[model samples]
Target: MKSRYIIASITGVSLSLMGIVGAQAYSGENLAKHAKITMTEAQGIALKARPGTITDEELEKEKGGSGLRYSFDIKGTDKVVYEVGVDAQTGSVLENDKESSHPD
Candidate 1:
């Protein structure tokens, strides 16, 4: 019985580690694989919605596929940063919020 329990624990741990490793490999800079819109198009869409220059971006999808969006961090001409999420499927802005970027 003790051996059985140890085997089960080892199996569970291995599976969990595999899952994490797989996910890390899966998300490595291949945001365009599942996006219907091009990264430039998405950047344009986000700029039109919020009006800023994109400084950074990443495509994100929830583990279960309930959410998929492109996250763009933009810096306005006046030096304010904005975080925008544009839907990967529909090419629409899902959400936008300003972030504090203190300039010294």
Candidate 2:
């Protein structure tokens, strides 16, 4: 009876962990699809347009929205950092602004 209980407990724990992992994977895939454009493609476009490379990229959840927002950073040749936003659904460039730059 004790052995059976232990086996059952272990199985329950394993199943719970599997469920958590599966949920995370599903969320990641959904974010990717909603973004419309892949990370690689965004990086390529940023590199071509901006002087510096892409430092970071992420999908942000808005307060009252169904789709996610894609945000990225690009450091220019003058060492200026710019924040760029792209529409997740249409892959349209929303905003591009220089946040900061190296002092003259």
TM-score for each of the candidates: 0.61, 0.55
Of candidate 2, the 10-residue stretch with the lowest lDDT total is: 61-70
Q: Write the per-residue lDDT of candidate 1 for residues 39-100, one digit (tens) a residue.
A: 77878999987887787788888532227787788887667888888888788788778865
Q: Candidate 2, TM-score vs. the true structure?
A: 0.55
* Stretches of candidate 2 exceeding 4 Å from the true structure: 1-30, 63-67, 100-104
Candidate 2 lDDT, tens digit per residue, 2-61? 999999999999999998787653324457755667766655655655658667677676
| Cα lDDT over the full model 2 | 0.66
TM-score of 1: 0.61
Query: Model 1, residue 10: what's the lDDT?
Result: 100
Best by lDDT: 1
Worst 10 residues of 1 by lDDT: 23-32
